[model samples]
Target: MLRVCSVFLLAISPLLSLPTGMQNVEGEVSAPILNEDGSLLIKSGHKSSADWESFSIAPGEHVIFEQASVNSSFLNRVIGNEGSELLGRLSSNGSIFLINPNGILIGPSAEI
Candidate 1:
């Protein structure tokens, strides 16, 4: 009887291990060097050059949005400016805002 019960339980074990139709998302990128104050050290590109860094993202099964282009207009404003860095955050409405340390908008502005 024990042998028969063991066989019955084994037959149902596969059902318990089935996936629930959930999938995972994962990707990787090169980590950047952060300053002592936790700011990223960005390397700007020259004219007619492409600039990029490898990035990793994990959005689980949900869709993840990638930025096609960083707002160079904002970065350009800081070309000769010192001690400026770009900071980004997601808004409650799902919009991305890049800000400077002083809480000023840092994207597409003539001044950084």
Candidate 2:
């Protein structure tokens, strides 16, 4: 059934490719964790940052960010060819500076 296939994909997604739409190009940021609710959590260390190849958030998806401190910031640069589409929730405790020369689209339902 479709539901079974979806569950199987979710179970094996981590082994196939990056779970979230983030691929770090630099800095010492941990890999994105796919939460039980299908949300994405990213944790960065002290004075640390990261650059991404592609950064996007589809509808119904939530991306949460946690840094070393409230003053700490993580810089994410999108170097991929396509632009970014943010149509979901982006919750961050610290600061998240996203740099995408191509484009950055924040949908109406997006929450920062």
Candidate 3:
């Protein structure tokens, strides 16, 4: 006889929707730009021992992180304020760590 066990994890929070036609922009972390359409672009890169000292997103805005090329082990962490939405397209082995007290919504294009 063979048996299998399954485990499920659930997060309870309000539903947030992602914006349409978001684009990726590459740049340094300190100089983040908010486009005219209310979307924020994030450049692909790695930061070591970096804290969320000045990272924040406003309400009703969408943030998109871009990578030069898909790297399976790419990892990025962002600490956002309440009432903002984050969206990204990650590699199969990529991972993102976000800390938002209010809430967050993952877009459909996210593989992980």
Candidate 4:
């Protein structure tokens, strides 16, 4: 279960750059695809470029990325702007990486 705070603020960082092998896609990017066998995949345009797209989450919105099974050690990675408040419960055997140049707030209810 992923829950975002009602009054969350997304502060844009000018110095922050996209991760290697990832590119910024124009327009808004949607949530990742959740597989039936408990695996999640964030669609990319191509294997060489734009492997992971950037997206925004509105305030009070809940985004859930679920996987049917855990086959690998790395599951997901989330990159947000500074001063963003992320609140939710994450239960998965794989790993999750959150990257923010400025800072981020993880609520007490959040579970990895």
Candidate 5:
């Protein structure tokens, strides 16, 4: 199952939708861009974090992290009523902490 999912992601990683309702509630996070090409690119500075009303991604969509260094860490806290539906890619040089109290569905095509 895992192997199949991996193949699926590789086949479809360019189509997209991104996480919405994001706000920098605290820390040094900045300049999140959702490009027309369908990727969400976020630059994470040292000790940066953000909050989302909901956090999710669709197949082929990506949540990419750009940081000063690989040791940089960022937090994404979901405050919405619904659980996160992560069915896409989260490519990061650093660590990403996705916190959703409701629940998180990391789908078959997900690559984190």
Candidate 6:
């Protein structure tokens, strides 16, 4: 009985260690750009330690990237996954910049 149980556990352990890919994807930061031919270019950045940064979103995807320091003032709200309109507010000490009219750059002492 013990040998049978050990064999079964060993057989299932490899499956338990399977890579689902989401874990690797989670830590990646992506920037999307438009090519002259109208194709999409996605550049991935590694997750940073400071957490106060922004990147261009992939075209046609409903998503938002936010930083904790400026969450309340800069990125006040994000549109839902359903594709609703978005509204944002910022503090006097901070600024927001729209990069290429697509990406939003938010910072404490930056400009839009």
Return the clash pairs for model 4, or none: 37-68, 37-69, 38-67, 38-68, 38-69, 39-67, 39-68
CA lDDT, every prediction?
0.26, 0.75, 0.38, 0.36, 0.82, 0.29
Clashing pairs in 1: 29-54, 29-55
Candidate 5 per-residue C-alpha lDDT over 35-81 given as tens digits, one digit per residue, 9 for 90 to 100: 78778898868777888887888877888888768888888998888
Q: Write the per-residue lDDT of candidate 6 for residues 26-52, one digit (tens) a residue.
A: 333344344465433332323312121
TM-score of every prediction relative to native: 0.19, 0.75, 0.36, 0.36, 0.80, 0.22
Off by over 4 Å in 4: 1-71, 75-80
Better of 5 and 6 by TM-score: 5
For candidate 6, the TM-score is: 0.22
Over 1-112, each residue of candidate 2 has an lDDT whose tens digit, in order, gives: 9999999979854432222356665556888888898888898865555666677887677888887789777888777776778877888878888888989888898888
Please give the lDDT score for candidate 1. Answer: 0.26
Residue pairs with backbone atoms closer than 3 Å in model 6 (clashes): 97-112
Report how far off residue 81 is in candidate 1 (Å). Answer: 30
**Distance (Å) between predicted and true CA of 82, model 3?**
7.9
User: What tens-digit string does per-residue lDDT give for candidate 4 at 43-86?
Assistant: 32211112233322323333343333343222223344334345
Q: List the residue pairs that clash in candidate 5.
A: none
How many clashing residue pairs are found in candidate 1? Answer: 2
| Superposition error at 93 for model 6 (Å) | 33
- lDDT: which is higher, 3 or 6? 3
lDDT: which candidate is best? 5
Q: Please count the clashing residue pairs in each candidate, in the order shown.
A: 2, 0, 0, 7, 0, 1
> What digit string (tens of lDDT, one per residue) describes model 3 on residues 20-105?
22222233333344568766554545431123322333234455555444541223333434333443332222334544455556
